[model samples]
Each structure stands twice: as structure tokens, then as C-alpha cells.
Target: MYVVTGGEMHQIDRYTMDQLGLSEEILMENAGQAFVRHLLTSVSIDEKVIVLIGAGNNGGDGFVISRLLAEKGFQFEIWVVPPVERVKGTARFHMDIFKRCGYSFIEYEANSIGFRESLNTCSVIIDALLGTGVKGNLRKPYAYVIKAVNESEKRIISVDIPSGVPSSEGEAEVYGVIANETFTFQAPKLSAFVYPSALHFGEVHTLEIGIPKIAFTEVAPQRQLITEKRVRTTLAKRPADAHKGKAGRALIIGGTQEMTGAPVLTTDACLRAGAGLATMAIPACIHPIVTQKLTESTFMKLPDAEGEIRSDVLKEEISYIQYDGIAIGPGMGRNISKPIYEALRSFNGPVVIDADGLYHMSNELHRWCEEPRSGPTIITPHPGEMALLTGRTIKEVEEHRFEYTLDFAKKYQMYVVLKGPFTIVTTPVGEQWVNTTGNASLAKGGSGDVLTGMILALVLQQHSVIDAICNAVHIHGKLADKMIETHDIFSVKASDLIHSLPRVLRSYRY
Candidate 1:
């Protein structure tokens, strides 16, 4: 589903009414009726509904909803925070109609204690204070009314987005109404999925307000909500005659003396992700440890110097093995290793760099991506590591994740996965896929390694680089969510996620 910003939604509304020839008043009626229907379905009509409306079109919507409810014998109170004189255009028409129907409307002023008293008396409050067009910090009567309503212990439902919440960035900058439910028009906004604002949005339901499909299609939003239907449509089923060799082979290179578990997790996750064969190359010292952890895959014991794989052994391993994709990093120590650097330079396959490998690459990571023989490469970096690699502060990266991820992918000509709350996968062509499935349960150690392995496995399976990253990100988060559903997030380990991958994949079967 397309995620529109406030501006885009406005354009969509205009296009729907002007180009599609849909009457504005008819659209308003549908919106009001849809909202009233949602309210009737979600809550009791017997409960007193106090609507706090602004002086604009949003208020017009509330007025219509109030009129519909009053006509249906549903007891309700309408409090126009701004006086009826302040209402303009279509809003004025609706206000006049409501007055004609003998529905009493209160014109609240700055010092009206009655507004607060009414809010307190109502079982549910409908906040239509401000619409998507609201910009910056709210001021005056609207802000005061929002604050008052929030203080009231009533179940609040917001029209469109929550009042005072920015629909684009998901930031509630100043005094936003927290609604128990938000009935948005058209489609879900980006803010509803993004962060802090996502928390305040509570349970959101989109009510179709008669916006023409052509309008939205013409305005094609760059951002989208990742739904199960999209995932199911994109995933390809295996051919009946497919063989093990055709399924693809993946190699994971990492794990030093003290961090044997990292490579094990990556290798195991790759196998669970359906790689026909998965192998790991670790420092010879930890070979025995990693081998003991998983007997399903092969292991390569690279020559070790100072208990870490050195660059000298890279040529030997690259020559002996031929794999479809490689996953590097994940507990690979930062110290200079000649064999490791050699393998990084010599390997000619899709590469997924994560954990310590990204740390080691640092400024040189971009250079490696620019290399002629480097196949479709993907760097999975959390905020700190991305900051280190790009020489930008963690704060800078977090603030402009979309821009940075896109820029870095284009500059390096490779896919980039900037992992965080909404794990973003940016392709070289500047397309971005934001995976919304994951949760805080994945904030544990070695979780990134598991993701790296999953991506590498998918890439080796001959999926497009973008598809591989997107599928891996979705599956990784889905597994974490599954784990959380079964056990407490605090108690779930990264290893548990690796164990649960098969079950998650099985459930995704169409």
C-alpha cells in the first residue's frame, strides 16, 4: 500500500475531486459516514461522544459525523473549539446544516470551563482539531483544547491522523493528541508506521473517503507498507525438477578465537534460509568449536596467525572453493589479517558484509564496492557501524537514514541495508524497501550475523540482489516477531532466532 505524506494526500484529494469529477460534498459525506460506521463498529453508540472540532474541513467532517449520529438516536455532544463564525467554505455549510437540524453546538472560547467539563463527562472523545495540513508547533485555542482533551480520561478517536502529529516523519513535536484509535482517510500515512508517532497512533484503521484510484496511482508514492500479499506475490516457488546444485551454495567467512558463535549463527541461519549448501571459513583455532556447533554444513579451517584468519590464506581458499555467494564479518576481529584482505579482494561473488567486517572495511568499504569484479554486494550495518563506515555521526545517520542509505547505495553501486527500527534496503538504482516486520527482540548480539547469513543464502539462490535483501530482511524480522510471540523478548537469544527460521519460513508458504 502506498504511504502518502500530507502534501501528497492533499494533491490526491484535489485530483480526485477535480480530475476524476467526484463531488467534494459527496466525498465529505462518504468520509463522515465511513468514520461514523467505524465508530459504531468499534465502540458503543450508547456512550456519550464529545467531538472537539476545529474551524476547517476537518471540523466539517466532525460536523457531518455528529449530525449522522444525532439522527440515529445516538446521544452525542458537539463542541466547536473555534466559533461557528471562524468556520469557512464547506465547513460553514455543514455547521449551518447541523444548526438547522436543531443539534446544539457549543462555541468554546479561551476561558470556557464547560469544554473541559463536557470532555470529562463524555465516554469517548473525537479529536478533529487539526488535519494533515497543520504545520510546525500548534498554538492557541487548538493547542489548549488538545491538551485538555488528552488530560481527560476518555477513549479518544482521531479523524485522519492524530492532531499535532506530523504525518510524514512520525514525530509528535508539540502537544499532539494521543488517540486510542485513529480512523485515517484514503490510506495509511508513513508516520503511522515509523516511530514515536507510531506509538501514539494506537490502533489505526483506514476509511475509504471516495478518493479515485487513478489519483493515487498517478501520484504514486515512493514509500509503501510491506504487506503479506506483496511478499507472497514476490516469492517464487521452486521448480519441480530443481536440483541441489541449482539451489545455490553460500560461504560464510568470519569468527576469531573468542567469537566462535558468530560464524556458527551465520552458517546455521544460512542453512535454515534454504541454501543448498552452507560453509564457514574461520580461524583454525576456532574451527573445532564451530564444527561442533553445526554438523549440517561443511567447514574450512583457514591458516591462523595470532588466532585469527590472516590475508595470506585468502588466495589458497579462493582457489580451492567456488561458491555462489559469501557472507563476511560477524565476530571477525579488527586486527590486520593478510589472508582475510586477500579473500576480500579475490572473491568474485555476491558478498554480504556485516558486523566486524564492516568495521574493518571502514573508509575502504566504498573502495572495495567500486572494484571491477565485486559482484552484487550488500552491507548490513546498524547505526554505529554505518556511522563509522561513512564518517558520519550516528545522530546524522539516524536523522537522515533514507537519504544516507540511498546516497551510499548509489555511490557504491551496491545494495545497502541500514539496519534499525525500520530496516531499510536501498538498491543501486535508488529504490528502497523498508522492512517493517522486526522488533526489539532482535536487539541482541549476533542477530545481525543471522541476517547476513540469510541474505547471503538468498543471493546465492540466484535471486536478484534487491529481492535477496528484501526477502532476507522480511524473513529476519518475521522470525524475531515469531520468537517474541512465543517467549519474552528479554529471554530470547540470537540462537533461538536461528532455530525458529524454518518454522517462520514454513508459515510463509502460500
Candidate 2:
């Protein structure tokens, strides 16, 4: 699904009203009615409900919901937070009609005892507060309301996004209503798929508010949700008589004597991701230990210098001729970055630069980022690595992840996988995909190693570099999501994801 920022969504809303001939009032009616329908199915009419109305068009939705609930014979309260006069435009029209229907509303005050009592008595709270217009932190009044509503511990159904949650990604750290469920109109806010705000939105139900597909414009939106359907379609189908050689050969090069497990985990995930042939290029000293842990995949014993692979070992033309894709940097340790760069500077194939591999690349930006490459390059970097590559503070990169990632990818002509919550996959051409799979369980060790291997394997199997990376990212996260269903997030380790790959991948294969 295409994701939109608040401003982009507003453009879509305006385009529908202006170009598609769906007026503001017509759209508001459709939105409110759609929300009400979902509301009826989710909560009982006999329950004591309260619709907290704000001052925007969101208030308009609340007023329509209030009128419909009253007509259904439900005893509900309409509590307007801002003064009734502050409501204007389409919302004011709805408020007038609701009052004409003989239903009065209570004027809610911050820290009001009456409001607190109403919250305590109500079973369901209809949060029509700030909606998508919220920017930065919440004001004192709305923050107070959000805190009180949260303390009430009532079943909260947010209108559109939860109040105080920014519709833009990476801006969800502000105070917001923690709703049990949220009924968003049209497309979901970009922030809905992104976290800490994702925590605020429980089960999100996107209700169409009469906006046609054409309203999103002739061109498809650049940012999108990496969905299961997209991943399923992008995945390659094995033939009836498939052979290992045709599946693709993946090379994982990294691992010092001290960090041997990182490369081992990468090899495990690469093979599990269905790479026909897998090879780990590790320091000769660690080969004995890695071979014991990894039995199925073969190994290349690179010459070791101080327990790390010397850069001169893999710089020859013959070294990478047999492999379709190469992944560097899991457990590569810190010292061999220059040698890593020398190897990267010579080779020409689909290469995944990860872990300390990126740490190495961070030093040679002029050589790697500025120079042209004969083949595709994929970099999987967490926020810290991304900051190192871009020379920005970690906070700056986190705050503007979309911008920084896209800019880096476009400028360097490479596929950029900025790993974190809601992992973003940005192509060299500016297209972006945000994967919603995976949980906090992935925050532990060895997660990125597994993801790095998965990317390399899928890129060799799938035709489109963009599709392959996105599918790998989605499945990697989806595996973690599945693990949390039967096991706790804390208990999930990197190896567990490798073990669960078949069950998760089986569901995707036709």
C-alpha cells in the first residue's frame, strides 16, 4: 500500500474534493459514517460511550458519529474540548445539525472534575482529538486530555490516527493517546506503520472515505508499505525439477577469531533463504570452529593475519568468479577495514556491505560513494552506521531517516537498507518501501547478520534488485513477528529466525 505523509494525505484529500468532485462536507460525512460502521461492529451500543470532539474536521466526524449513535438509542456523551465557537467550517456545520437534532454537548475543561468523572464512567472513548494535524509535542490542553484518557483505561477508538501522533514517520515520540484500536480514513498515516506511534495505534482499520485511486495522482506514490502480497509476488518460484546451481550462489565474507558467530549466523540465514550454493570466506584460524557450527555450506579459508582475513586474500579476479552475490562485514572486527575497502574497490557484482564492512566503507566515502561501480551494491546499516556513513549525528539520521536514506541512495546510486524499526528500503532511484514486519525481538544481537545474508540470497534469486531487497527485509521481520506469536520477544535469538524460515517462507510460496 502507498504511504503518505500528513501533507501528502491532505493533498489527496483536497484532490478528491476539487478534482473528483467529492465536496468537503460529502467527504466528512463519508468518513464519519465509515468510522461509525466500524465502531458499531467493534463496540456494543448498550455500553456507555463518550466522543471527545476537537476543533477540526475530526470534530465533524465525531458529531456525525454522535448523531448516529443517538439515533441508534445509545446513551452517549459529546464532550467538546475546545470552546464550541472554535469549531468552524465543515465541522461547525455538523455541530449545528447535531444540536438541531436536540442533542447538547458538554464543554470539556482541562483538569475538570466533571470531565474526569465522565471519563471514569464511560466504557468506550471515541478519540477525535488532533488527528493528522498534530505536529511536534502536544499542547498542555491536549496532553492533559491524553494523559487523563490513558489513565481512564477505557477502550479508546481513535479517529484517523491517535490524537497527538504525528502522521509523518520518525516524529512519533511526542505524547499521544494510546488507543485500543484506530479507524483511519483512506490510507493509513505513514507514522501508523512506524513506531513509538505504532504502539499507540493498536489494531488499525483503514476505512475508505470515498477517495478514488486516481486522487493519489497519475504517478504512484514513492513511499509504500512492504506488504505480504508484494513480497509473495516478488519471490521467485522454483521449477518442478530445480537444481542447486540455478538457485544462486551467495558468498558471505567476514568473521574474525573473536567474532566467528556473526559470519556463521549469516551463512545459516543465507542457506535458509534458499541460496543454492553458500560459501563463507573467513579467516583460516576460525574455519575449524565455523565448519562445526555450519555443516551444509562450504567454506573458503582466507589467509589470516592477526586472526582477521587479510584484504589481499580476496582481491584477485578468480576469488569472486564463482559467486553471484557477496556480503561483507558480519563479525569482520575493526582492524581490516582498509583491506575490506581494497577488496570492495576491485570486485564487481551484487555486494551487500554490512556491519564492520560499513565501518570500513565509512572511511572511504570519496572512493566508494563518489566512484561508479560495475555492479549493484547494497548496504544494510543501522542508524549508527548510517550516521557514520553520512557524517551526521545519530539523532539527526533517526529524525530524518527517510530523507537521509533516500538522499544517500540517490547520490551514490546504490540500494540502501536503513535498518531499525519499520526498516526502510530505499532504491538508488528514490523509491522507498517500509516493512511493517518484525518486532522489538529483532533488536537483539545477530539480527542484522541474518538480514544481511537474506538480502544477498534473495537478490541473486529475484530479478529486480529493489524487489529482492524488500522481500528479504519483509520476511526477515515477518519471521520475528511470527516468533512472538508463540514465544516471547526477549527469548527470540538470531538462530531462531533461521530455524523458523521454512514455516514463514512456506506460507508465502504458492
Clashes of each: 7, 1
- lDDT for residue 22 in candidate 1, whole number 0-100: 89
Q: lDDT at 456 for candidate 2?
A: 88
Q: Would you list the clashing residue pairs of candidate 2?
A: 438-477
Write down the TM-score for model 1.
Answer: 0.91
The digit string of per-residue lDDT tens for model 1 on 371-463 reads: 734567788999899888778887777766766877888877778898988787888888767777888988889899889888888777666
Q: Give the top-scoring candidate (TM-score).
A: 2
lDDT of candidates 1 onward, in order: 0.80, 0.86
Task: Name every residue pair that clashes in candidate 1.
Answer: 310-339, 311-337, 311-338, 311-339, 311-340, 312-338, 312-339
Against the true structure, candidate 2 reaches a TM-score of: 0.94
- Put down candidate 2 lDDT per residue, 1-510, tens digits, no spaces: 778888888888888777778899989888888988888886887899999999998889999989989988888999999877899999999999999999988888633667888898889999997868877767667788889999998899999888888888666265789999999888877877655667889988889888898987653578988989899887977777778888888889899988989999998999988899998888999998999998999988888789998766767522777778899899998875445556665566799999999998888777766675768989999999999999999887877888899999998888999999889999989999988888899999999999998998888885688888999999999999999999997899999999999889989995
In model 1, which regions exceed 4 Å deviation? Answer: 170-174, 312-316, 337-348, 365-374
